[model samples]
Target: MQSTVNYLWHTDDLLGQGATASVYKARNKKSGELVAVKVFNTASYLRPREVQGREFEVLRKLNHPNIVKLFAVEETGNSRQKVLVMEYCSSGSLLSVLESPEHSFGLPEEEFLVVLRCVAAGMNHLRENGIVHRDIKPGNIMRLVGGEGQSIYKLTDFGAARELDDDEQFVSVYGTEEYLHPDMYERAVLRKPQQKAFGVTVDLWSTGVTLYHAATGSLPFVPFGGPRRNKEIMYRIITEKPAGAIAGTQKRENGPLEWSYTLPITCQLSMGLQSQLVPILANILEVEQAKCWGFDQFFAETSDILQRVVVHVFSLSQVVLHHIYIHVHNTVAIFLEAVYEQTSVAPQHQEYLFEGHCSVLKPNLSAKHIAHTTASSPLILFSIANETPKGLAFRDPALDIPKFVPKVDLQADYNTAKGVLGAGYQALRLARALLAGQELTLRGLHWFLEVLQATCKRTLEVTRVALLFLSSSLGTERLSDMAEVRGTQELRRATELRTQLRALAEVLSRCSHNITEAQMSMGHLSSELAKNRDQVHEDRSIQQIQCCLDKMYVTYKQFRKSRMRPGLGYNEEQIHKLDKVNFSHLAKRLLKVFQEECVQKYQASLVTHGKRMREVHDTRNHLRQVGYSVATCSTKAQEAQENLSKILDQLSHQLLQDRAEGAEASLLPVTPYPIPAPTDLVLHMQELYEEMKLVAFDLQDNNRIIEGLNRVPSAPDV
Candidate 1:
């Protein structure tokens, strides 16, 4: 054992207590590491094995960037007090950051992304592992900033996390009040409780709120006052909007424009940056977080780009990187053997460097010049073993097809270069409708599908071949690993990869189902292009476009109605964003087309029908909850009408007697019943109702007809 530390692990150093546990910064002399340990104040000592086993098992399987690392555990040891040894992130919790001088007023946008990246990575890791990190908040995050630029946040305290198999009902309130999803509160209030819990989306929604606070330097919905019940808290988070203008009032401080709203000290950024950030931020702050693209897509896209972008490939990665230049000359003998002794090189080759008989298999250069290799480049060598005199003329070695490349790497005697860099070989195709410059047709769509299938399949097959070769060599150890001074870590990669593949398959399937719709959109995009004999003019019109554009946008509602499959949830708009296809950014390109086409020929008439479609798409979700609540009012009204009919027969006889006794019929002054403001539940339904409306109204007329204008119109310059 090392020398004893001034503080001992979990010796109860007397820090203040929290709702769940008592915290202490302690030293583990055996490991010589300082760790912040929390010990739950258990009233009884029971099931020691069960407690220790679960914590160890879960911690050992967890691998996430934001989560705090678990080092060692002593559940029934050390004077029978349970203790968890963890990596001590020195900067403390995000709550501390909020209270510190560095925050000044609040966190910046860039810093917020960094925080979300870590936390989301953690949540995603758990989700992939089929685990739920129930308690997520600023207090749980340990922001580690040691030396300059040497910091990474960790999601700590998984004491509340649960495995999928546990089947624990979500009615148990476990998190901070400010960040709970309204659904959980509703589940709590249920007379018949449900264990059919929401998914990892809960943690994401909390993270978004945390970011909102970080951005505005205030709670997204600050409650009227203090420690709130779940009902009131959920009411606000569900009903209240983040206090701001529609986008934001952000602008540069010292530049031409100043911020209209109070800016955070940490964020002295300009409005331009905020505008760029809206797309992603909108997704994060979505009311139903489940609909946001899960972290799996993010990782998959990133991994795909990283692997595909390498300029060179080396078969033998085992070659020592640093010794390369000096060790290069050592392989000369083996190379020469392959070049001359066992090879067919004419003795006259040395005489005529510019040889009369040129073999395609031979290196393009003469034998006088040797092939070059560099530290950053792959080794390439080629030679023909065929002895036919006419071999040089028959085969062009440079044109060797990719499927013929060998996977094996020989030391030097004989070899072939594998994995050619095939660029500028995209099988670019346009839909038949696009090719025709008119309305979309089934024949055109069929051809487009075939092309897309061929391209994607080829890409996948080629990549799988490469990956298989890699797997055979690497044996799936790990692409890379990082070190923490003191902690136990697991790969957790298998889980993430599965989630990604499933998500990709889902996106592909969805696209395939509505491929025609997508084609129609693309067709309209093409009509926006002004065709010359040789090339398309850069300018075009959006409003006055092709018939396909009109069909795609104007008929989106009809198309969706026709194609609606029941499986995409009871309410499709609520569950999936895919209604009619939209390449949102690509539409900007078509917007430029608006300038070239005569507006009179194809000014896409503003389809006010969009307003009615909004109501159609959103009705079930918009009024479902409110309908349930107000059912009582509607029921009572019906009961009163029925009761009035029952009493009318007896009342008619009494009315005749009362007329003789006439009681002042002409009237007390009339008063109006004041209309009560809509309740929180009513308001939330409206907000969701409005959001769905926007998506509904976003449709375009893909069939618009465009005639080339004599002169181009000006577009918004951005």
Candidate 2:
């Protein structure tokens, strides 16, 4: 490849190439600014001078953000070839992005939307300036990363573009074969003779094809053989089939063609977006020029879609209770306004937490930013203003009853009760076993007695604390009162509480008795072990300590209802509900009511809204079909009128010929026939188009209603 385009630009890298020109990434000699230089080949210059300069003129006239800007025109230093310096898009062409493995199925919904808006806006600008882009494909659209890290798509490669009015016609066939109109494809690719003139609607066809490829990662029409290999079959498919009737075809060797009409499951666009997109594709992808949508209608519909908000599921207390449809451009404050409308919680009182994030969303942050951060899960909104909203007032009647006893400090009680029995038993066991069968010296015996007395004192202190804890916690006053209540649930709870208290008290009493017996035997064991006279006292002390451990273990086993414990077994800290706040039962009741009032109602409303949205989608689709029928009828009607006029002219010419031959006397009087115009059919088509627009508007309005509903606040979790 050539290393330099001109003395002014160093063309070390080739960006892309087309039949007419090759684009290169170049740097200015003086400024060092990176730019793309489009250098036309000798064949391009061989075309008419007007055709060669049209792209430069078109780019110079356009100054829109969505359209690529032209910098300057220069001549290559080597061949003196024309070079167009244009804006360098750092992110490359959209076609390059789509070819990546991640986007093999299609551009993700967000990226696709960006392409849709940019292309629509750029084409709208072109229409306003009476310019037609004969070629509109992903390869011709460039992508740039904006300062805020957003993707911006811009229309580029306007070589096939030209200034053409709506009524004016051009016979030139120029565009990629797959995105070309059938008339253009027949003449340009298949090398077929053509007399049909192309209007601005041809651009619409290309735009639709481009959008379909962007959405689905494939062309709308394809045969067993590719477009180039089977050009005649491709032409037949484009002309014979209705728009969107068949998406693509697949066939095995010598097998029948399998046609797919619906988008594949791999398509990433949501059903809601697809519903809006399908009608637009249907109207613009029409093969017949008369049935296709004009740029004005196309702009109107696309702008409407861009303006509409994206729907996001909002969850409260981990339960999905609402769907928020706020525009991505809207700030968190505006989103809060929508939330307020649904939840009746003021903006100041609402705290929005995105999934996997602890920090609440800032009020000034854009919804688009939030969407990017929390793309994996629904946003969770907590209402700090209302614990309970109106119309969902519910209080457990059982909670109204006054507490019959003071609340127990569970942590304090559990700490006191933990080592009461275990410590006493350990002390007695150690003293008897370690000194067994050995005569203790006077000093050793004294030391053993002292340790025993200290152990006894500590055991008493712990026992006192444990007894106090049990008496305060397991009092019968509350349980007795609850048992007298008429409600079955209350009565059952009271019985359970009574049984637990009784079992605990019995075990503590037995363990305390055994400990007291063991303490008394410790003195006897000291005398016997010191004199080395008998093992009787040592065995008795061991037996008393063992009995205490056994009692504690049995009680623990009964409490746990499992045999997974070792040693003295496990002890669970009992939670005494001494106050009227029965949180466990109250939580269950509140959850039930919450389900009935909030979750279930929201679900029902969602179902209804979904049905309505589908209805509107169907209505828009029907309206598009009606518009197609009307356009076709109008075209036929105009053709018939033209044919009638020709017939009349031929008849008049024949009469003149006869008169010239001196046979006028033999001819009968002629009658003038009335011919109908296609004005009514055209009017009907306009009406249907208007109806489709109205349906689109209504669908947007309904989306707002579906995003929010009057309902209860989220119930607090226990």
How do the residues 619-651 of candidate 1 rate in per-residue lDDT, one tens digit apiece?
212222222222222233223323322332233
- Model 2, 311-397: lDDT tens digits are 553433222334455677789888778767766677765645443343356789987776542223445454433232121112222
| Model 1 C-alpha lDDT versus the unseen true structure | 0.38
Look at candidate 2 and tell me the lDDT of residue 676: 21
> Each candidate: RMSD to true structure?
41.6, 42.6
* Each prediction's whole-model lDDT (CA): 0.38, 0.58
- The TM-scores of all predictions, comma-separated, are 0.36, 0.47
TM-score of 2: 0.47
Deviating ranges (above 4 Å) for candidate 2: 1-12, 243-246, 253-261, 314-718
Worst 10 residues of 1 by lDDT: 701-710
